[model samples]
Target: MPKVISNTSPILYLYRIGGIQWFSKLFDEVWVPEAVKNELRAGKIQGYDVPNPADYSWITIVNPKSMPSEWLALDLGIGEIAAMAGN
Candidate 1:
């Protein structure tokens, strides 16, 4: 089993279609940043019907300290920043 760090979009899409189980089968665990978790929660509130990412036991959410200033300078969304920097 392999461990993988994941971004928001892929997780969102997979959860939207109810395929989140694939992560468990493929990897020992899939790590996500707090930002990604927030994104999913927001999407659900916005009526996107996204599944709760936390419901998946294989998905671990992390809060990384000190994101790269360069990535932050890119003015990307929190999810993107977290994905690149959290890793």
Candidate 2:
């Protein structure tokens, strides 16, 4: 089974465009880091129309055990960093 580790933007944009189900259709499992989940939750709290990862059965929330020190030097959002780290 193939899986993909996703960040926040793809999920957000896909959900907005009513294409979020493509994740389940394309991959056996959609893995999301905790940071991605948090970002979506924060967006929802801000009243934006964000889909909750928990709402999708195929979306699995994963917390990376440790992030690479090199990644901390890059200018990326926590969700992106976490997704890469998870990968």
The TM-scores of all predictions, comma-separated, are 0.87, 0.95
**Which candidate has the top score in lDDT?**
2
Model 2: worst 10 consecutive residues (lDDT sum): 78-87
By TM-score, who's the top model here?
2
Q: Tens digit of lDDT per residue, candidate 1, span 58-78?
A: 788988777867776786888
Alpha-carbon lDDT, every model: 0.82, 0.95
1-87 per-residue lDDT for model 2 (tens digits):
689999999999999999999999999989999999999999999999999999998999999889989998999999999999884
Model 2 TM-score (2 dp): 0.95
| Candidate 1: Cα lDDT at 65 | 78
Instruction: Give the clashing residue pairs of candidate 1, or none.
Output: none
